[model samples]
Target: MTKSTFHAAPLLTLCLVLWALPLGAQKKKDNLQKPMAGPRATALRVSWLYVSADLGAQKVGRVQIGREIVVAEKSSDWLRVFANTDIEEEHTSDAPIFDTNDTPPPISGWIQAKGIVIDNTPNGDQILMGAAADQEALASDPRGPVNAARTAHLLYRRLVEMFPNSPLAAEAAWRAADILWQLQKADSSSRPSAKEQAPYLRDQMDEDGLKKVIKFYPNTRQADFAAYELLDNKLCGDWQGQEKCPEKESEIYEKYAAEHPESPRTPQALYLAVYRQAVLTDMYTADNNDKKSDAAHNHARELAAKLRDKFPQSDYTARATMLVFKLDQRIPVYGIEKE
Candidate 1:
């Protein structure tokens, strides 16, 4: 779904907010071009999910420097790193906030994660700054609807740009496609002049990206959302809506049914296609006063009958049947002069 306009922040504004900091503090640049552990050093090993290491309280602001690996007696546990800080600030705090006894620092860096750093210290504010940057980036995105619909289209384009072929990328693609479909339904007018409508057509070029995500990660939560969104978007419009609607249910029904005939959702998909066609036809005939022909009304009656006969247990059967009765009542009497 699109986020509220009130919540959207411009990307530049977000960058500025994230980078703003107190002046005169020096940031250390890593001098080593590449890591070099001598032949005697053992390589550092850690798991992505759970690697335990104790960070000492003294090492708060200073950067921890160490070889990639150390020899002989190294255990499987993560190696502890320390930063020596002045005792004056440490002691001056009102409470005993410092965990002097083998406590670990909350800040951490993932091996795969990479980005520009902005902070006063190498360790403390640095990590916080990275998180802040990410948060600001997320906040700055103005992708959601600005109207009552609360529709947001997360473009897979952005996801693929930031992360390629990763799980997060897959997730982003799925969410983006889902949001795009919601935006389509909530705002029928995707024309540039329609300010209330989100600009998905202009923004997205990630159909292939989305397909890859669904193909590779069908069991993921985002994949499930993508599947539903694809279904909904595919079923939202009728043949008459071809020019206005990005997706057409009639087309989708034919394809989905042919491909997955045994699928449990096949019935629902076909029902929606017929229902949309009938609804749109009925609405057009009713609005135009049927001056030219009774084609639309006749089609609606035919579709309604088909719905009732073919899917006796469908919920749409009741609604369609009701519409048929209503149409019958109105056809002979509507807009005619009384004697």
Candidate 2:
């Protein structure tokens, strides 16, 4: 999923070609005459990391200082190192967060060992920053939407699995789950059935990754949107393991409305609860259970009325008003009278 607009800090530049070539051409005067001649040492400040200990090796990326790293297995003037990958997640808050976290494999490269110091303290943020660099580069590729989404899903899932606590983890999970729902060729003509959904959607990951964001990280902004996806228009069949519109589906919406009344999402919850009940009436009607259908219709009418009275200014008010009339008409025809 694309992040909502926010003032994000500048993203780290790590991809080899996109970043190194331009900088390499400009810094000729300050370039080291030769590789450092000393014992292996940790990178002290922001410096270029190379694919080999030799000064001539391909430049992979630059690393932030204070990232504890191991030495090269063989002797060389350069220090061979792997990017750190232990970033901790952000703290829970009601605030909006827009950054994404990626946890792909670390980029291995060598750096000049001259000013580097001997140290081994790892920083979670550093590891996470490196991951973020790799994922962003892959995502920005000009590959067609279908192909790009497929590749992004892999990296996003890795971020979620490797750094569940990072602020970006929730966003990554959201993207991975959302992409699967869009893989079909929608621009063609007709909508496809569940089987018609991307062939690998179910294979990439289950629905748990999406739902867990609400349960495990409710305070994060991503959970609110994730909840919306889980309850999409009251259809919980796609949520958790429910095969149909289970009772729990409506409960989740109503509960979200009651608990997060101050959230901008509260109106959506209230409105969807009315919709869910209305759909249930249709389900029973299709099953030829008139009594149940009337009962459900009346219940939906009650919810729609409540929605109208509680938030008359909301756009849902117009829909809920019509819903009340529609369900009211059906309720009486099914032989249900006002109590």
Candidate 3:
């Protein structure tokens, strides 16, 4: 055989292999997005989870490729699961974490069962959907009353644990913190006083957890919430009678606002940043330390003024106006005296 003829045959064979690559790649992508419907279903295989078990059910949400389902119940083709933000709560009162009657309603849904690929558990098509689907799905559950909210929080934690290296990890972690905060407020509304609510709020949404979310997913929406929550939320300590750590709140807000100039979070964060600085002044005066109050008052005023000029139309601007007035007139901040 002539050398040129042999080369032509080899070139044709290579061309055929190259031609098939896209189809094979596409098939793999589809498999990762959803498992083949078979005799048994596994959790975390479907990309777009159906609202119902029926194959034709409308898409209600998505299950991340690797999110673990507690799987309270399952049919041959579908699994029932829950998803949400996870928050840590400490028992502040003798009150059962919640009244036995108040057990959070289970947030439940159905998803097709799929299989796990044990050998390729950590990489490739399993990791990216170009955007974070499972992470978002883990968070996508509609905010609900305490019961459903609690379940959703559990789901977030599951996603984080099951896919620690996935891009969605930050989102899952943030949702977990957010849910716990919401649950905390709900639990406390029925209670009598700050002393009573103090315990419940003490350790909920630990500071380090929020910091980790921001550290890993700095520009994501989850990070934005984590950053803001670390300041304005209890994660940074806004209560009294417990180990007080409210002094650091203003610094976090200022740093977050400065770092993300155009972030939507910046407007609100700047406003709260100023609010918390005034809080320090108020706290000092409340504690009978007028000398310690002066620096915070000055800084708060500067931040308030900056907000007034930079974000005149922000939702927090009116509050900024009130902040300036209070700082100047030395009006005792309404809640500061007691809290």
Candidate 4:
């Protein structure tokens, strides 16, 4: 559960590749600037980019609410921007295109200035955060917009990039990373490899964004949450009736619990460890390894006791208590149940 401390080496390499532009090269090339040089902005509502400043100008593309943009110039009521419009189509939304070094080329056009929020806009961070939350809610609903989740992810990322000093920055970063992770997880879970017993057989969730959250926002609750998400990549896709799967996974969860004792996920982690131990008890008994079975039973009880002592009010603690009672009554926690 304890990963190697993240360093800037990978990021440094990426920077060299993406931002090695000669001085003034960015400005000379179609007025497109590095993201940091321009005033970061997002659409406050679904809008359109036009080929010209006039309302009758040909439509260049539709800009979804929360799509990130960088303003290079502004007219009376129009802003010239380089918008991140290379997003994957809604039908093939499995791939996320927001990585620092892997971003798609931007589209340049004029957008109406009315519905845009720039970095200097008053309370812009709060406005962006609220928009992201609304999008997230839509993403969770079956009848919501097809691209709501992606928009939410983009909005959250913009909040962190534009308002790094905002009190909401840490949570925004975590939310962005979590949304991407969940999208990737859902995509991976639908593949045939998802039926594999070993997690490595399936596609792995990208860890770069999660690692960035931990790197930039260390010691925060969001960092702890990000770390907890990383564990998903190491878990078994299916236990496959193997005691070793649960045994190793239990150790991993226990280590996370010990390292991040105050994390909101710690109680659930402890409960997972207890559940695995209970499964191990049944598996060992089936193998006629009475000694190991007895040991696992005792360990399960001990971990359950710890959960109750440390998180008495937690739902996980209550679940662990029920598990312990079933163990004491010689009930099978795995395999076919007795009638």
**Candidate achieving the largest lDDT:** 4
lDDT of 4 by residue, 239-311 (tens): 8888889999999999999999999999999999999999999999899999999999999999999998999
Better of 2 and 4 by lDDT: 4
What lDDT is reached at residue 16 by model 3? 30
C-alpha lDDT score of every prediction, in listed order = 0.37, 0.52, 0.53, 0.81
Q: Residue-wise lDDT of candidate 2 within 1-339, one digit each (tens)?
A: 222211111112222222344544655646423322222233434678777677777888766543434453434656666553333212112223422354333456777765454423244323443544454455567763333444455445444543455567667766655554344223221323333333333222234545656665666667776666554423322433221443456777888877666556766777777776776776667678889777767777777777777777888867766766767665432224454
Scanning candidate 1 in windows of ten residues, the lowest lDDT window is: 38-47
TM-score of every model versus the real structure: 0.35, 0.44, 0.45, 0.85
| Deviation (Å) of 227 in candidate 4 | 0.9
TM-score ranking of the models: 4, 3, 2, 1
- What would the per-residue lDDT of candidate 3 be over residues 219-261, giving only the tens digit for each residue? 7787777666655344332355321444555666778788776
Residue 165 of model 4: what lDDT? 83
TM-score of 1: 0.35
TM-score preference between candidates 2 and 3, better one: 3
Q: How accurate is candidate 2 locally (lDDT)?
A: 0.52
The best candidate by TM-score is 4
